[model samples]
Target: MERRLIHVITPGDHYSPRTGSAVPTVVHGLSAHAPAGTEPTVLVARGTYPDRYTSADVVEYLPGTEPGRWDRRLDPLRGALGVRRASSRPWAAALHDQDEWPPSVVVLHNAPQAVPLVDTTRHAVVLYAHNELLRTYSPREAALTLGGVTAVVCVSDFLAERTRRRLPPALRDRVAVVRNGVDGTVFRPGRRDASAPLEVTFVGRTIAAKGPDVLLEAVALMDRDDVHVTIVGSSGFSATDPLTPYERRVRAAAEGLRDRVTIRPFLPREAVADQLATTDVVVVPSVWPEPFALTVLEGMAAGAAVVASRIGGIPEAVADGGTLVPPGDPRALADALQVLADSPDRLAAEQDRARRRAAERPWSVVSAELDALLAARLDGQVTA
Candidate 1:
C-alpha cells in the first residue's frame, strides 16, 4: 500500500529555544511516527526564525506580523483580523494550491486562522485543539471554524469536555482525547550529588497563569537556607510591559530569599535535559487549568520528583509518579516542598516511579499510535 502524506498546520511560534511548547513537541513526536514511505510536512507561522530541525521532511515558513501594543490591548478584535489577514497571505495561497498533493489527512494544531484554507481543500481534517479557544473566541467565530472541522483532538479530558460543551452538537461527537507524550531517552534520571542543597526548578514563561507568584510565596514561607529555587524564562516581552502582576508579586515575595531564588532567561532545548537532570525536584504551580502540563512530563522523564498543582490535566500527567498540591495554595505547595526536602528516601522513590512512568510514554510509542490513527482515517477504517 502506498503511504499517505500528512500535512500539519499550526500557528505556534516555533524555533524558540524553549522546550515546553506542546505544539513543537507534538509536531516533533508526530514526525518521528511518519510511516515508512509517508511524508510529514510541518507549517509554522513566522516569528524570530527557529533553529533548523534536521529530521523534518519539510518545514514551511508562513508570514505573520507581530502584534503591536494596540493590538495587544484589543486582542480578540486583533486576533480575528490577524487570522483573516494570515489566511490571505501567499503562504496560505500556496497551501491551498497544494490540493494536488491529494493529502490523505490534514492535522491542524491550534490554527483557527487557517481554517478557511483547510476547508477549501479536499482532505480529512482533524483539529488538534491544545487550549479552550471557545473561551477565547466569539461563538460565531468558533461555530464558523471549529464547527466545520471534521474531527477534534484534545490533549486532555478537561479540554475535551470543555470544548465539547461549547462546540455545536454536530462537532461535539467528533471530539477525542489524545494525551501528549514525552521523549524519555533525553529526559532520564541523572547523577545527583548528595552534598548539594535541595535544588528546585520551575520552567516555562513567567506568566500569571503559570503562578510563579505562588511558587515564590511558598519558597518565602519555607525560608530554609538549604533549599534553592531557580526560575527560568523571560519575565516580560519588553521593559514597557514589565513583568506580569503575578510575576511582580513573585519577585517581591522572593526578596529576602533572592540569593537562593535565581531568575534566568529561557535555555536551549538541548540544555534542558541537563538542567532537569541535576534538579532534585521540579515545580509547576500553574493557576489556570493547563490542558496538558508538558513540563511535568519532561520533569518526570528527567527523574526529578515533580511537584505540580492538582488541576486540569496535570493530575492525569502526574498520575502516581509525583506529588500534587492544590492550585494557588502557598501553604499546600510549601508543605509539599518541605516533604520532599525532609525525606530524601521518599523523593528518591517518587523519582524512581516517575522514571518508570515516563519510560512507558515515549514519543516513539505516541507516534506509532498517531500513525495508526492517520492510516485508519486514510483507509476509511475509522470514523470520528
Candidate 2:
C-alpha cells in the first residue's frame, strides 16, 4: 500500500513565539491530533524564529513577501489580480521536490491562488479557509482557482456560508464547515481562588478592532474595586514590534483603570494557556465582525466564564457557554461583567457550562472530522 502523505500548508509562518496569529496554532493542534495511518507535514514560510510546536514535520518555503503589516494591507489588492497570486507557485513546485512519494492530499491554507497552483490531476487538493478570504476573489478568479479543488473547508459555519456566497453557484457545493477546536490537555481548567476578586482577562491583538479598549472602558464603568482585569497581547505577535497608535490608545484606556487593570505584552502559546487557566472571566469584546474567535473557545476550555461580542461567528462559538453583549457597547459589557461579579454561584455555573461545552469539541473530534473529509475526497466521494 502507498504511504498517505498529507501536506498541510500554512498561510504564513508556522507557530513561533513571534508569530501571534491563530492559523499556526490551529495547524499545530490539527496535526497533533491527526487520524492514524495518515502522515501530516506542515509547510511554512522561512522565518528567523524557530517553530514553537513540533507536532508534525515542518518544511520551509520562501514566500514572495513575508507576513507583515504592509503585506496584510495589500492582500486585497493582490487577490484582485490573478497574476499577483502567482507568488505561491514556488511553494507548489516545492511540493514535488519534498519527497520521492507524492502527497495524497494537499491542504492549502487561506491562499486561494495556491489552490490552482497544486497539481490537482495528481493530488486531491483542499482549500482551508481560516477567514472570509473567498469574498475577495472575483467570480472568474474563484472558478479558476477552485475549479479542481476537492473541498473548501471553512473554520466556521459563518465562514462557510460567507465562502459559498462569494463563489459561483456551481462551485458552492464544494464548501464544507469544520469549526476550530481547542486542545483540552493544555487549556483545561486550573485552580481559581473564590476568595479573590473576579479575574477578568482580554486576550488577542490589542487593537481597536479586537476591542481591548472596549473591555477597559467596560471595566471602568463598573467602578468596582472587587474586579480586576488583565489585558494581554500587543499590536502584533512580536514583542519587539513597535506599538501602533491603536495599541497606544488601548493602553491609555487601561491607564484610567489604574490598579484595576494590568496591561501586558503578548506571550507565547503556553503563557496564553496559563493566563486563561487562572482567569475567572474571559472577555472577547471584538468591535469588528470576527469570523470566529479562537480566544472564546480557549477561554471556555480553561473554565472561564466568557463574555463576548455577539457579532459574527462568536455567538456560534460561545453558544450556551457564555454571555453575549453588543459589540463596542461598554455599558452592556459592564452589566454582563457586574452580574457575574455580583453572584459567585452564577459565576461558578457559567464556568462549569464553559468547561463542559469545551470538552465536547476537543481537537481529536476536529481531527477525525477532517480525516474523514480527506479520506472521502481521495476516494472520489464528495462530502457535504
Candidate 3:
C-alpha cells in the first residue's frame, strides 16, 4: 500500500512566534494532530529557528529558492500580486524539485495565488484561506489563479462565502469551510480568585484594525478602578519592532489609566496562554472584519469569558460562548464588560460556557476534517 504524504506549507517563517501571523500556528496544530493513516510535514521558507519540534518534521526551502537580502524590497509588491515572497517563479520552481517522493497533496496556508504555482496534475493542491485575500482578484484573475487548485478550504463559513463571491462560478463549488481550531490542553484554564479585581486581557497586534486602542477606550468609559486591563502586544509581532504612531497614541491613552492599565510587548504563545489562564475576560475588540481570530479560540479554551466586536467571522467563533459589542463602539463595549465586571457569578458561568464551547472544536477535530478532505481529493471526488 502506498503511504499518503501531505506537505503543509506556510507563507512565512513557521518556527518563530514573532512572525505574528496565525498561519504558522494553524499549520502547527493541524499537522501535530493529523490522522494516523496520513503523514504530514511542514514546508517553509528557510530560516534559522530556536531548537524545537512542536509541529511535524519541517523542511526548509531548496537552496536557490531561498530569498536573497535584496528580495525583501519586493515583498509588498509580490504579496499584493498574490505571489510568494521574493517572487512566485523561483519558489514555484523549487516546489517541483521534489520528484523522489512528491507530496500526495500540497496544502498552502493563507497563500491563495500560490495555488497555480503547484502542479495540480502531479499533486492535489489545497489553498487554506485564513483571510479575505481574493477580494482584489477579478473574476478572470481569480479563475486563472485558482484554476489548478483541487479545493479551497476556508477557516469560517463567513470567509467561505466571501471567497466564493470572488471566484468564478465554476470554481465556487470547490470552496469548503473547515473552521480554525485551538489546542484545548495547552490553553486550559487556571484557578481564579473572585475576591480580586476583574482581570481583562487584550492579546493581538496593537493596530487600529485589531482595536487594542478601542479596548483602552472602553476601559476608560467604564472608569472602574477595580477592573485591571492588560494589553499584551506591540505595534507588530516582534517585541523589538519600533512603535508606530498609532501604537504611541494607544500608549498615551493607556497612560491616562495609570495603574489601572498595564501595556506589554508581544509575547510567545506559552506566555499568552499563561496570561489568558488567569484572565477573567479576554477582549478581541477588532474594528475591521476579522476573517477568523485564533485569539478568540485560545481565550475560550483558556476558560476566559470573551467580549469581541460583532463583525466578520467573530460572531461565528463567539457563538453563545462570548459577548459581542458593536464594532468601534467604546460605549457598547464598556457596557458589555461592566455587566460581567459587576457580577462574579455571570463571569464564572461565561468562563464555563467558553471552555465547553472551545472543547467542541479542538485541533484534533480540525485534523480529522482535513483528513476527510484529503481523502476526498485523493479519491478524485473533489471537483474543479
lDDT tens per residue, model 2, 134-170 = 6667887788778988889888888888889889999
Model 1 accuracy (lDDT, Cα):
0.72
* Poorest stretch of ten by lDDT in candidate 3: 1-10
Which sections of candidate 1 miss by over 4 Å? Answer: 1-12, 15-20, 45-50, 61-94, 119-121, 136-143, 236-249, 380-384
> In terms of TM-score, which candidate is strongest?
2
What value of lDDT does candidate 3 attain over all alpha carbons? 0.80
Model 1 is weakest, by summed lDDT over 10 consecutive residues, at 85-94
Clashing residue pairs, backbone N/CA/C < 3 A, model 1: 15-50, 187-301
Residues 1-384 of candidate 3: C-alpha lDDT, one tens digit per residue: 132444545434545554546877787778788777566766665554644355677677643454666776666556557555554544464475546545467777767656767766667778888888775567867777788887899988999999999888999989988988898877998988888889999999998999988888899989888899999998767798888999899999999999999998989888898999999999999999998888998999999999999999999899888999999999999999999999988988998899888998899998889778766766753222
RMSD (Cα, Å) of candidate 3? 3.5
Better of 1 and 2 by lDDT: 2
**Alpha carbon lDDT of residue 128, candidate 1?**
79
lDDT of 1 at 91: 32
User: 162 in model 1: Cα distance from truth in Å?
Assistant: 0.8
